[model samples]
Target: MSTATHTATRMATSTAGHALGDSLTMLRRNLKHALRYPSLTFAVVVTPVMMLLLFNYAYGSTLGAGIGGGHYIDYVTPGIVLMAATSGALVTAIGICTDMTEGIVNRFRTMAISRSAFLAGHVVGSVIQTMIGLVLVVGTALAMGFRPNAGPVEWLAAAGLLLFLTIALTWISAGIGLVAKTVESASNMPMPLQFLPFIGSAIVPTDSMPTALRWFAEYQPFTPMIETLRGLLLGTGIGTSAWIALAWCTALTLVGYFWSRSVFYRR
Candidate 1:
């Protein structure tokens, strides 16, 4: 390479390293903040656990029969896990909105750190925390007699898919936070997303729903994701649902990230 080219490459590498470092530092900060204030995290973890228990116990008998005598807990755990992740995504918005409203982002703007690191930190940290919460949800489901047929490889793939899904939701929530002028608004904005999966095949089979709702449950983004996750855990046929779910996840991630960045720049 020419000397000029070598110099540019070195500079680019150095900048990328700095950005990663800064992002990690901020990720630690976000995690620490969660540790200090456990209520939000607790709620995020508990809400889905409660839902899982409620659905499995209160309605499991009915729903189990509805799905051809299958174990309701097994059939519903994936959806509940998605709910937990979405609940955690709400925390990302609240954290971001809180920072923005409290002038922390202003302080960040005054610093020399890479601007992207702030969002990256929030997104990454939220994913880590949310994954931890997902584990708790799954454990609870197991305690409730949920049994999955997934082997080690399937479990890993399910974890990977959940991580990707969490990332997508977190980014979109980040954008909502950036756009919201108040923390209340930020919390409210992603509420629909948290519950959207319920409208899918979360509680029961999509085919069992009314015609219009069934069409929506099948065509909406979360149904394929839930189905793909169910397939991974239960050793069922994934078919094209995995591809469709991945496409939705990819599209949401891209849209949320750029949308967050655009709003951040404006602010």
Candidate 2:
């Protein structure tokens, strides 16, 4: 290669390396914080588990009868899994907001690190934390008689879908955090996302709702996602829900990513 070309290649490689290293450093920092103060994680995990129990016991008998009377826990487990991830993602917003407010981000800005690494760290670390919460929730569901017909391939697909959903939501949470003026506001911003499952097919059939509410529950992003997970794990037909869920995830991720970048650079 020509000298100039080789020099450019080396420079690009070095920049990529630095970016990766910086991102890893930030990820470690976030994970350490999660380990040190695990109450938040426990809180996130507990909400979904409690919901699972509440629905399975208080409402499961009545609700299960509506959907054939025996597999309500199976039907609701997918929704609770998503709920767990959503609950964990709320912490990403709070953590990001706290970091932004404490001037630590300003210090990072002064360093010769990747500009996106700070946010990327939170996103990656949050995904991992969310996955752990998902596992715990799923385990609890199984112990409570939630059974799935999924084989290895189907189980892997369910895992991939969950990870994609987590990443998409984490990005949105990060963006919300960036836009908020305070940590409290950031924590509150993603609250609506957690409740979305209730209005959708997560806990009950959307078809049973009133016309307008049913229409919304049928068309909303979470419905398709919950359907897709149900299809994967319980051998239900995915139909168009998989495509719709993918579209929602991709669109939300792109919007959240760009919005966060814009807000971050502006500040």
Task: For candidate 2, give the lDDT.
Answer: 0.91
Candidate 1 displacement at residue 68 in angstroms? 1.4
TM-score, candidate 1, is: 0.97
Top candidate when judged by TM-score against the true structure: 2
Report the lDDT tens digits of candidate 2 across residue range 1-267: 999999999999999999999999999999999999998788789999999999999999899999877778998999989888789768899999999998999999888989989999999999898899899999999999988999999999899988888988999999898888898899888999999988999988888899999999998889999999999999988999999999999998898888888999999
Candidate 1 lDDT, 29-117, residue by residue in tens: 99999899988888888999999889988999998997889788889999998889889878899999999999988888889999889
Clashing pairs in 1: none
**How close to the true structure is residue 34 of candidate 1, measured as C-alpha lDDT?**
89
Candidates' C-alpha lDDT: 0.92, 0.91
Tell me how far the alpha carbon of residue 246 in candidate 1 is from the true structure, in angstroms, after superposition: 0.6
TM-score of each: 0.97, 0.98
